[model samples]
Target: MALTTYSFKDLSGSMSHPTIGSYIFTGEGVGDISISMSTDRSAHDVASDGSIMVSKIAGNNGVVTITAQQTSPIHFWLLDWYNTLWNLPTSEWATTSMLLRNTSTGGSHVITGVSPQKVGDIPYQQQGQRITWALMAADIQHNSK
Candidate 1:
């Protein structure tokens, strides 16, 4: 058998928001999961051994861009959904999988690691298809365990 993998940074074609194990996202049409990451590093230098230690580890600071699109989409309710997800109780954190798994793809991916913050500044744009404004997430995978 061959092992396949998906990336959060993937924003290729029309794709639905990845399933949170089974926690489904309502209203779907060409949804996409686009997120970004940044890292902060510290260096330690000791004269005793003349060695410097550099670190570039996971579970650092990062940002998220969660969005969805519809051909003849709902105009305004997206704002409500975006704001609602942001303020959802900590328990309602959207646990995301690292692999791409949707109705078009296959079953659900089994890696629950992403936790998004409140979606902010939902501004819609129209290109080939009507798309929901890319709402910025507070944080994504800042504490990967």
Candidate 2:
């Protein structure tokens, strides 16, 4: 499938609900937003005689790296959401509902557990006050067929 990335937006063009390619993304920006997934995994092995045996290995949840940017008012709101969600007292991070859809291939997955940024310094534009944020997805779906 020719799955190219595209900017996701609502009919009214609000950042509240957006998608990157077929995957739903949430951010406030006007830029070349992208989504890339990496599977969480573990591996164990045993060495006996002259051979190595795989003891255990498994793929856990995954992460979706999101990069996006916004100008002015939207940037303001984006910063607000990121600040509030991460600065809270809760140790367990909250997740947002995300969906990955491939209409051409008829495949999809529902992901949860998106983390909020709190501890790091978010980059800001010097000119137009453009807010560009690089988000790493905390948890994600496998996009099972």
Candidate 3:
């Protein structure tokens, strides 16, 4: 019913290198949510073809069971110049739903229907390295007592 933003940053050297990011949600009765991402570039060529992997930052044995809704769409883009407009979509785009556990165990439960869709160009920029992803949850019609 309500919308919240969870942000994580990669402190690793360059965009070419892989780094782990983390996010934490601490609210009561949190259920049914969607997630998405936005990039700054319009295409991903040999010069800048990088991928982002989203997962629970905490180990697989923690206390929360985070799930993605079916309608939620994940997206990526590639930009041309700095603040310019010459971008195109990339060939590597996909979406999937899964359940992430926050514990010491190292495993995840993949859910069905929740997947990422390639709707726009795949951008590649060092400044755009900060991936902006969002999640929307299913509507809570009402609460019964």
Candidate 4:
């Protein structure tokens, strides 16, 4: 029998933007990270006559979601980036990029053309809230060692 193990500590990631510089995630302040393609790789259509067709999607667009604790520095960093983008003109807006790697699995992902979907929502309560930030990426390339 073979066994495999995964750990969050083995995952390293960083986010970079021209206007706001960069932030390296250290498994602190961050609760979770999720990556997904914006669209499916293929689409299929079937006709009543038993004819089938498949369309290939050329876009490599994707989305990355980051969840951070309210007290974490990463939360503040992302907030600042969102604010900066909001105050800038469309022509002057800058895109962000991120690199995520899993040391244990020898896997990595490069995400480019990133832009925030919106500011994280804030809620006031007894317990601290976790902020979720959604970023759209024009392309995400996954590599395996």
Candidate 5:
């Protein structure tokens, strides 16, 4: 079994309903895969900004997790989706780097990095209001058997 990373760019959507980002991973056999997300800021900050993380799990197929963080106090939207690739059982897996962009006229969150062992933290000053940002890690694993 082996692991691989895939990425998509400029993804947008609302909270209740989210959109899917696609990627194609070519490999001999599928293994257990875990998915996670990290924005330019910490996951907590992204969540404070009205974003929610949802996992889309699948085996031997493409996986996309939606970040439906709130755009504002009254509205919620998805910034981007990312696949976790470093924690697989295979040590021979490759890392896939992706950069998500804001395609909307308004502000958008972007995700970076592909490590599951790294802790997600807020790296920016709070804008608008000082909301207590909380970080949470969601994991989805798929077994190839």
Candidate 6:
């Protein structure tokens, strides 16, 4: 018999920008991370004649969402990036590159032409809350190695 083990700690990622250098993403203070395609690979249309046609979709876009505790250093790092970009002139604005990897499985997701879709929501309460950041990518490639 064979056994395998996995841990959220094995899941990590990084973001790089011309201005911010690079920021690592670990399990520390992070709640969850997700990557999804903007659209499916294919679409179908049914005709009145009981025939169906499938059209291929050119969907190279994707979104990456990261949830982290407000107390996490990453939370502050992202906030800084957000504010910095906001203050920069449009001519100085640039895209970010991100890489998400699973050490356990040697799987990785690479995102390019990345930009923050919106600022993360802020919350104040007795206990800390998780802030979600959604990033849009013009190109995403997945490698399952």
The TM-scores of all predictions, comma-separated, are: 0.36, 0.52, 0.20, 0.93, 0.19, 0.91
For model 3, residues 1-145, the per-residue Cα lDDT tens digits are 9774432221111111011121233212223333222222233344334664444332111111223222222111111111121121322111222333323223223332221222223346654322223322111111111
Sort by TM-score, top down from the best = 4, 6, 2, 1, 3, 5
Per-residue error (Å), model 5, residue 127: 34
For residues 12-109, what per-residue lDDT tens digits would candidate 4 score against the true structure? 98989877789897878889999989878899899999898999988879889999998889899989988987887775353788999999889999
| Model 3 stretches with alpha carbons more than 4 Å out | 1-97, 104-110, 119-121, 126-128, 132-145
* Full-model lDDT for every candidate: 0.41, 0.45, 0.24, 0.87, 0.28, 0.86
- Global Cα RMSD, each model: 8.2, 6.7, 20.0, 1.3, 20.7, 1.6
Clashing pairs in 6: none
lDDT of 6 by residue, 1-145 (tens): 9998777889888899887678988878889888889979998899999798999988789898889999998889888998888787775354788988998988999889888888999999999899999988889999998
What's model 2's lDDT at 75?
49
Kindly report which residue stretches of model 6 are placed more than 4 angstroms away from their true locations once superposed: 91-94
Which digits, one per residue and each the tens of the lDDT, describe model 1 over residues 1-119? 98866443332222223321232333444355545654555545566788766665544444434455443232234444445545666555543333333443344333234443443
Measured with C-alpha atoms, the lDDT of residue 67 in candidate 3 is: 35
Distance from true location, Cα of 117 in model 1, Å: 4.1
Superposed by TM-score, candidate 5 places the C-alpha of residue 63 at a distance from the truth, in angstroms, of 19
* Residue 112, model 5: Cα distance from true site in angstroms: 5.1
In terms of lDDT, the poorest run of 10 residues in model 4 is 88-97
TM-score for candidate 4, please give it.
0.93
Lowest lDDT 10-residue stretch of candidate 5: 74-83
**lDDT, model 5:** 0.28
Q: Is candidate 4 or candidate 6 better by TM-score?
A: 4
At residue 127, give the lDDT of candidate 3.
Answer: 41
Q: lDDT, candidate 1, residue 66?
A: 48
Compute the lDDT of residue 71 as modeled in candidate 4.
88
Clashing pairs in 2: 29-69, 29-70, 30-69
